[model samples]
Target: MQKKILLSYIVIILLAVGISATTFWNTGYNYIEDENNEHYIRQAELIANAFELTRFDSANDFSSFTKSYADKYNTRITVIDLDGEVLSDSEVEEQLENHGDREEVLDALRGEKASVTRYSETLGTDYFYYAIPVASESFTGVLRIATPFHEISNFNNSVKYSIIRAIIVCVIIAFLAAF
Candidate 1:
């Protein structure tokens, strides 16, 4: 029957649309994630190099330096000494717990560049973190920079919604064409 043929055609079209949409969504998500990783890594390296070039006379000087950079970049910055002491944080004034056990920090301490996305207990939020080893005449430590995870989530949500809308439009078009 014509009705049966039309129904089959519509079903095939819907399946194709669904498959394509899924592939697009996954590819977009991965691309965004990779871009973010590269961006953060470059930022961390730049900040670390800058830190290595500077020598702060006191803790206040160190804190002030990091605070300025954090404000400029709209991010959280922390300097942790080799002994795991929190020398300074752009966001926190009080001395917080040691970061030696942190995965990214640990990797940085071993002379490796590292990055991770996780919840920060101190800040009580999820963040994308990047860390690098930095050394200066007056300081030797790890420099870490973090940006809120919500930025990535917001972009991903927009892409997902757009894809969903596109699938809806395609399904409607396919149905009409098949009929």
Candidate 2:
């Protein structure tokens, strides 16, 4: 009976250790993903701010201006006035209501770096947005850039798959050692 109790306790301890280790590794993966997202947001905001600073104002239409800028920068760019009016977009000029209401746009209009993520109903996927303020002599506005979240999602999924593979390997090793 004492030997049976000892074996049971040993098994419980090993199981608890395995569970704790898996939990710890999963937490680390989440931290890495969060950091990657933050890095991307900062980079996008910086790109938007730089574009806003050097944007040409002499163009008759801001759409053309945005297109040219996007071509040059290899990223999407949108300029919005203080009131959330879309002044320029690299893609389309459709009447988008209250652009400033978005957290990133609002922060940019208020002279701060801001970022947000959301699911796009039209695109059927998630997206990330980064924005910063455009300061000029006369007017203050916002410059926003966006990228699809698929890139990050892919990376995260790869990481998760690797973690699972590692756990399976670990379990196999443990079983072999026990045997």
Candidate 3:
């Protein structure tokens, strides 16, 4: 009877620890991703506002302006006109294809805030992209900001590893207490 009671208590404790760890693992990843999304949205809006205030003489001028902001933020920035033409890219020097068909760009062109994570063929890397519509006196289009997806993945993986370690510690503690 005593052994049965002890075993039940150990099971309960282990179950509790497992549940808590699972919750933390999920919540941590969501919180990190949300924070990253918010950060990029705010940055994109700010850049769009700033862009509305300036008039670029040519694509080179536009690229120069975006390059400065990209360097400052350590992210890529691209401007796409209403017709889907790539007006300027902070990182790309050559003429690029139209972005009209991209889901995020389409959403932004329709005056909606948009975000997506995907592989970029041009940059040869995965990125988290955030875009917003911009309408200035001289320019009207979408301004997009992107950061490498690895950054967010690294943070999420760190959280997952920490949770796994915690679970292992808890299991060991539970076993010791059971004995």
Candidate 4:
């Protein structure tokens, strides 16, 4: 009877340890993803701020400014006018047909930062879209930036590896304790 009780306790403890380790790993993964996303968003905002300082003589001048600046971060920037027109874009020479209707741009037009994620048909993968209001006094155009999903996905995989390592260490400790 005593042996059976000891075995039961050991099994329960090992099960608990496994569960705890899995939980810890999942939490860590989520934290890493969240942190990476926040950091990238901040980087996007900094780019927007820099674009604000370029002193464009008119809205048309914004095209060259966005192209030159956004290229550094592997992102595409779209400058949208208050009327929802694409005033300038980093990737395309012609105006985007759906510029004004885009949610991120609309939110920026309302003086708010907006971000969204969606699958890109062109890239054959997902991408994140970030939009923030340009700090211009007269125009209410938005600066929308896009980054491919692989940026975050790669970071996520790294996070997953770290969590798996931690879980393995925890499982080993649990096994040692059981023995």
- What lDDT score belongs to each candidate, Candidate 1 first? 0.88, 0.71, 0.89, 0.76
lDDT tens digits, residues 1-179, model 4?
87787688777877886788679767977887677667767877888778777677885678777777777777777787788887887877865676777777788888889888887554477878888888754455788888888888887787778766876787677657656
Candidate 1, residues 1-179, lDDT tens digits: the string is 98888878987897899889889888988998898788778877888888888988999978988998898877889999887788999999988999999999999899888999999898888999998889998988899999889987887798889889988988888777776
- Give the Cα error of residue 119 in candidate 2, in Å: 2.5
Candidates in descending lDDT order: 3, 1, 4, 2
lDDT (10s digit) by residue, model 2, range 1-179:
87686677668757976797679777977897789767766666565555545635553346775787677656567778888987776765575556867878877777788878887553577777778787655346887776678877788788878877776777667656555
Off by over 4 Å in 3: 1-9
Per-residue error at 5 for model 3, in Å? 5.4
Between prediction 2 and prediction 4, the one with superior TM-score is 4
Model 4 clashes, total count: 0
Error of 2 at 89 (Å): 3.0
Q: Report the C-alpha displacement of residue 84, candidate 3, in angstroms.
A: 0.9
lDDT of 2: 0.71
Per-prediction TM-score to the true structure, in the order listed: 0.92, 0.73, 0.86, 0.76
- Measured on C-alpha atoms, candidate 4 has an lDDT of 0.76
Assess the local accuracy of residue 100 in candidate 4 as a C-alpha lDDT between 0 and 100: 75
lDDT of 3 by residue, 32-111 (tens): 88998898889888888888888877777788878999998888999999999998899998999999998899999999
Candidates 1 and 4, the one with greater lDDT: 1
